[model samples]
Target: MNAPPYLSIVGWARNDGYTPNYAKRLEHSIGFLVRQLDRHRIPSEVIVVEWNPPPGSPLLADQMNGFLGGTSHASVRFIVVPPQFHRGPRGWQKRGMHVNNAANVGFRRARGRFVTPKALDTFYSDKLVSTIGRLDLDDRRVYRCDRLDARMEAESWLDLADDELLAALARHVVLRNGRLTHSIDWKMRDLHTNACGDFILMSTPRWHEIRGYQKDPTVLCLDSDSIALHAAAAHGASEVHWQEECIYKVVHGNTHAQRVATIWKDWQLKLDHYLILRHRRELAMNLRVWLNYPRRRVRGLEEILAPSIERHFVAKAARYAKNDTSLVTNDADWGLARESLSDRTVVRAAWDTP
Candidate 1:
């Protein structure tokens, strides 16, 4: 008998109004993913979904088409989610709606037995593909992995000291490990939850069984991971933390400080709204802890805290805030920094001034 076809990788690119580099970045990401998949000998396809077409944004679509044109992956396809309906709340745009819709469209068109929806901004290593390939798809299971450092180019403004950067990266490793080793496995209730949509692989049948994502057009500030997790759990799915290195670098468009401030502000608003809706006193309290306490304690806190707050609190507040527990409830590990001793690996600065 022929071996079963592997998972179908569905990627959605929602460029609200980005320039040509956005397309370049998307192409680069897709190329990297294709190469990784090829290395693993996994059958995969890339679906490029462009949403909310920007005025005079032909370059992005053209580039995407061009990238797909030369691909050898027989399953790859490109689609455009035409600007059809405005379902989101007034003044609040639904960025994920486009993604959900596009993925849904692709899901219908996909022939693979498994469907894994991944974010466009993520850059994956070969380990990611291998990890996904190794996951068990028979039972209802959710597999998750942690992210590596965000990739900041030499000219990017997010350049930080080697020690500081590694410290920040370590926090993610610690947090992910903490959640897996402690909370989720131990069944300890906590304020923080683990439901990141990125790097999560699930079977396609279960995906559609959950109705995919809610059609709430007004649901702004909500994350796709929380929705997926909740739906999966409600449908009798269990989550397992894959203790493998599936590293992906996040690319930031602003300075570390600016990124932190922006995240904090957004979390403040989201937590406030969550408090009113859920009426949970601990949520409000946890929001404060999430917003302030961790930042005050951790070194090189800017990089990890911003995204952590968004991932653990703001985006998926309902799931995390419902539980009043934390993975790291102490301050001892907060200030610890681990530095690499090897000088052979060159650590370049963010900017190379001529």
Candidate 2:
């Protein structure tokens, strides 16, 4: 039997107000993701759907159509969905939902056998590529990585200054394994919930079989991965945990307390409420103490120490930004580091389009 032709990697681009450096940061992040695919030698094409394009802005769909018309990825053809065909519910203002919808649009347009819905911010390992290779199409299993919070100490990188830059550098380093000796591990064996959309990989046929994301736009905090996993599970699809160190770098400058507070506020407003699902599945299973702890303790820490962490990150970013010749940028050392790490041969495959 012939191997699948391509891997449809679906992602989103935001039109929200961005800093001057936003495009560079986004490029690096997207580049990192693409590098992982390159590492696997996977012939893949990316679909970047836009949620809310600025008025008179070139249509994202047109951009995609142009890309598909021009670029070639072996058997894969990159394309973008026209905005006219893209529509979802309204009232929920969270970016996640918008991304989820955009991803679904990519999914519908994919002509490959396998469709991988990936977060633009996350990176992959050789292990992920190998794991996806073993999937049985008939079984339609959804694979999820045990997520490692890639939040590192800002001072680790010597080139960034300012809290934002430090936080960003710390995130980059952690995602790239700048610190920590061993990879963190997580398991969903006992959890009765779905996988995070950040890195969920599934077959294309199965994705369409489920009818894609709900059309109701009012659903906040709910996304394609949550809905897809649930649908797949209901269809008797099995779930497996790939416990390799897949890092998810959350680029937020808030503490756990702040995150909790944000979730609460968002939930109350009915804007984008879905933390309860996460709590029941991943957080409740692992960070039970933090979840069940008294509100007073959580609030106290948020008030007392969050400022310190923020300050440290700011200082670190500032310091690093001033020094471009930091040790972290030495490519020779990075090459050596890759060589010293355990040798795991990761093969990249083309996105499977049927």
TM-score list, all predictions = 0.59, 0.53
lDDT of 1 by residue, 220-298 (tens): 3234455555556545567676555554545454322232333345666676678867866555655554554323112
Candidate 1 structure, TM-score to reference: 0.59
Q: What is the C-alpha lDDT of each candidate?
A: 0.47, 0.43
| Clash count for each candidate, listed in order shown | 6, 37
After superposition, candidate 2 runs with Cα above 4 Å error: 1-4, 18-20, 56-88, 92-97, 130-139, 152-195, 219-224, 253-354
| Per-residue C-alpha lDDT of model 2 across residues 1-354, encoded as one tens digit per residue | 145445666766654433233334444445455555555555565555454554565543443332212222323233333333334444333322255455656667655567767665445544665555443434357666654445544423223332344246335553332222211222212222323666656677666656554343332323234445545555445766556635454444532324433213333323213444444444322332333222221232234211121121222223333332231211232111222111111222333324
RMSD in Å for all candidates? 14.7, 17.0
What is the lDDT for 309 in model 1? 39
> How many clashing pairs in candidate 2?
37
In terms of lDDT, model 2 sits at: 0.43
